[model samples]
Target: MFVAAEIKKNTYYDSVYLMRITKEIEKTEGVIDVLVGMGTELNKELVSSLSMMTKEIESLGPNDFFVVAKIKREEIMGVVTKKIDSLMNEKKKNNVKEHSPATLDSALKYNPEINFALISLPGEYAIEEAKKALEKNLHVMLFSDNISVEKEIELKLFAKQKGLLMMGPDCGTAIINGIPLAFANEVSRGNIGIISASGTGAQEVSVLIDKLGSGISQLIGTGGRDLKDEIGGITMIQAIEALEKDENTKIIVLISKPPSENVAEKIFKMLNNSKKNYVVNFIGSESKNVSNSKTHFAYSLEETAKMAVELANKSTVRNKEVDAKCKKAIEELKAKEKEAIASAKNMVGNLSVQRKYMRGLFTGGTLALEAMNILRGRGMEVYSNLAGDERFILSNANDSYRNACVDLGDDVFTRGRPHPMIEPSIRNERLIKEIRDEDVLVILMDCVLGYGSHENPAGEIANTLNLAKKDMTNEENDSPIIVVSIIGTNKDPQNLKESIIDLENAGAIVVFSTAQATRIVAEITKSIGEC
Candidate 1:
């Protein structure tokens, strides 16, 4: 065990390049972990968290990029450290067509035909860069969080005036022209387009659409704040108009947590006049029957994707195969629920009154909300940090409430590190401590797999869970039940077949959709809770 560090002064690299380098170094023999990124305060904190910090790193600046690794031996550190530059050089060699732009202005000058810009700089700096992109007639996707709502509104207004899409100041996922962007999945190009205010909501729905043999024409993200009262759905309104006129899109899907009352009313009005068919899944709102024939209101992502497919295939004619796929998956889950509950009751002997609550530790915000809604629908009390009701907000994010679900990917949990989707270290440690509490009856989870997520998320999840359960049973308590909704497709870099097998082998109950997983969770807790 030794640590190696390097500081490249005045160098800039895209996050994608750094992540790839990190993954490659992690695969090297004797390397325990790796971190490669600019020497920003957050990146410095990331290395310091692992005790890999040094005087070199302490002196580094924001514009500098670094590669930090912890290895088994000082000698082996040299072997593994060189892989970063080696692999990155290979990347540069393969890219014969890409011209290195010195700055954003130079980037646009290199190619004036560029239609979009993606800004992931610090939040305070994002608004100015976004304005510059809009001035150049380029759409902007702001991937950084922490931008003020006022700034978000101002930038979005400027974009709307220019008739360009400003995706996010914290937007996580989007797919444009058949290309997957940050935190997105790859799907075939087809007639359906997605406009979402929720990142993981769009991800789950896109994967579901891909699984159903339908495909996506485009996915436009309206940064989560767009629908709030202050911003008022500016980007979404523009997207609806753009997609309505897009000949390639025959059907559209809008997915998000419920918007402000006024914004919701405005959206409904826009949907009413939409010339093309569309489905709406406003999760927090009531399911209403919109009088417009072409507009369908969906209460869940599965329904939204399925309904959009049905409408695109020709409204009123259902795809029996797709319906059967949904039916079959749920039926399988129901059967497993019965078998697992009976087995749990038998193994644990009797239910401890203390072990009667559900703790949802989710990386996907949308999945957490979906599960919360399901439990609420079934008359169960569930608290979520993401919920509008301040009462449900946890006083300490590290602590749990009566019935709690926490989005591990929220800014609170991600201040000094990458998102849980990319780094499961924090969540893994938390889950271990959670399972030790006798009060935790179930741990509902989401293992999201795709590009820009943890390379092999299930590997860490399965291994950590198995180790934690060992300690639980040694104390003569039953292992807490883990129900998972894996958001992925077979086309992902991490093989879907093998990943599911790993989870199954680790004694997890995996479901195809978040909705089914939530149903199973409610049933499990109810069966044990009543006893």
Candidate 2:
């Protein structure tokens, strides 16, 4: 392989754009991996992690734009570099073809009605850009992560006082005025509105709503940290107010991976005063359900969407077909789990191959939380970095406990790098390590698809899974079962049918719903019975 670096002095692009550019270029033929960004210590560290680092790259300053990649041949280097240039040119080509706005103020001059600005600058500059947008009377979606909690509270409070909504400092998904933004779906607009601190959490519920024959009215993303004690649920409360006053919304759904106790109480107080119907899916929270004729509690994302749709349509009776599917799913899991247990016990006592417990390496944080919750519900002591009892906290994200689920998208794992959704290389790098453990009976995962995610997510790890199986078979141990939940639709850029088939072809059990996959994992754990 060959490593190539391109240095363009005085050229600058925000980190988010660079992330997307790198992903697209990596798809080119003969390209192995890629790093595209301004040359800073963080970028250098990221490129180095992929073994493409060099003294020249390390010497680059923040002002210099760099394209670093590992290619199969020296000749492909030119093609890859040309592709990067073409991509940059394409990004610079705006629809209006006027002078590109140098400042937020100048952009506002071009179109005064721009009430929403999406900010993805570096964290240090995120606050200033957000303030500029707020001053211009525009609601903001801050996609940049790493902004301090203190700054978040300050900006959220300022936006609240001005009566404008601010989505996130690390917000990843939202839909407003019939348009999808930042890791969202293309579901039709209807009467159900969502307020979420979780990115993929909101995406899951909204997409499920679409599948349920109901659609979303709007989705307001409260950046993942909005519900912390520091932010005090500012965007969430603001969104609730906005949705309540909007004539289009008739039902409200709140999605999050649990909130602070004080904040949940504050939200519950707000919920009591609201007139619309409700379906609240607060994963991993011990909060009790409070339901009236209009309010309902949902324990899972699938249930949340179903309840919200039924409330929107005033349906009181559950469908017999749905009940039958549930019964069938439970039965099938039971039978398959029984067979798995027998196979494990009868495998010639190859103690070297006796698989024990489960390990989850998830790219989407919410899906990981969902899996963790389901496992815990099944009486399994599951440890996770993002959600769980403190005792179950992962000592180090890289280490696995009895039953461990690591959110690869967690801040620690993705620090100084792109999200797994943007670049699954890191997850792939780690999955190889996890699969080598014969004690791991099964590996559970989720493949999330939609706008602003990998174009072919399943394909990223599909071939590698086969490699894992081949190696395990060579070791004379049972190959770890790969159970996956694919969250996507036919309309996604990564064709859903192809993605599912890719996994299935690689000896994976691909489930359509995340909830089902989690239950299967729980069942397998129970059947395996602790090694």
Best by TM-score: 2
lDDT at 341 for candidate 1? Answer: 54
Ten residues in sequence with the least summed lDDT for candidate 1: 343-352
In candidate 1, stretches whose alpha carbon ends up further than 4 angstroms from where it belongs are 1-8, 13-61, 64-98, 287-289, 316-354, 469-477
Alpha carbon lDDT of residue 50, candidate 1?
A: 83
Candidate 2 per-residue lDDT over residues 431-478, each given as its tens digit: 888777767777888888998888788998797887776775444545
- Give lDDT tens digits, candidate 1, residues 36-147: 8888887888889989998898888888988878888878767765776688689778887967886789987788788989888778677888889899898898998889
TM-score of each: 0.83, 0.83
Q: 154, model 1: CA deviation in Å?
A: 3.0
Residue 387, model 2, lDDT: 50
Scored by lDDT, model 2 comes in at 0.80
Candidate 2 shows a clash count of 1
Minimal lDDT window, size 10, model 2 = 344-353
